[model samples]
Target: MENQQNDVKYEEEYIKNSRGVELFTCRWVPLNTEPKALIFLCHGYGMECSITMKGCAGRLVKAGYEVHGIDCEGHGKSSGLLGLISNFDN
Candidate 1:
């Protein structure tokens, strides 16, 4: 995990119509001072990526790994409401 004090910065956003609904997303790009090795990320539940996740992204950026993530539609900030919606559907 990348630690604080690293000037690494990342982008945050959402992915739309991914399978079903929009996906709240985030991106962490390495400094690009050197070639990146890999990428790491996690999908959200039903909301836009928040500061908490941003910190995580920053860390990944500092680690020299491209980071990408998505907030699961109808879960994160994509669209829809809470589990109640799913319950009703079921």
Candidate 2:
């Protein structure tokens, strides 16, 4: 577990959609190793990906997979009204 934690690499960033709302994003990957696969995770409504998805993401990274997560609009550090999804199509 300690070795896995030391080998894990994580990053957080933000991206804007067409509507210019910033969405919080994160990535977890193993250091000095090529990922075997990629997994994208979306947190539940009213939850932030950073908090809700960290455990799973860490495990995946430790297993040599790249894990990514994004906080939808209105959640986490994303720009929008809390607990609201402005558009289902977005």
Candidate 3:
């Protein structure tokens, strides 16, 4: 994990959805250079983006790609009832 952190740039933020709900987001990119591609990662149910996706995102960043992740509405640092989604289509 320590090796992955070295020379890789990481960032976190919150985005508001149409319903005014805050969603947690994160990204990883190669340090001192632009990424050749962008990838969006999605974690499984009951998993947080930072925890489960970090290693993979780090590797991708090292491989000349930028990786972005988002915690679902009810998971991680997002605001909502745990393990709950109001609608699948939303």
| Residue 29 lDDT in candidate 2 | 79
Candidate 2 Cα outliers beyond 4 Å, as residue runs: 1-5
Candidate 1 wrongly placed segments (more than 4 Å):
1-9, 18-20, 43-48, 84-90
RMSD of each: 5.6, 3.6, 3.0
lDDT of 3 by residue, 1-90 (tens): 223367787888899999898999998878878889899999888778987898898888888999999999899888888989778886
lDDT by candidate, in order shown = 0.57, 0.85, 0.85
RMSD in Å for model 1: 5.6
Supply the global lDDT for candidate 2. 0.85
Q: Is candidate 1 or candidate 2 better by TM-score?
A: 2
Tens-digit lDDT string for candidate 2 (1-90): 123457887788889999898988988878889999999998888999887888888888888899988998899989899999667885
Model 3 residue 11 CA deviation in Å: 0.6
Best-to-worst ranking by TM-score: 3, 2, 1
Per-residue alpha-carbon lDDT of model 1 for 1-90, expressed as tens digits? 333245554565655583466556666665645637656566444444545477776666676776676665565555655632554454
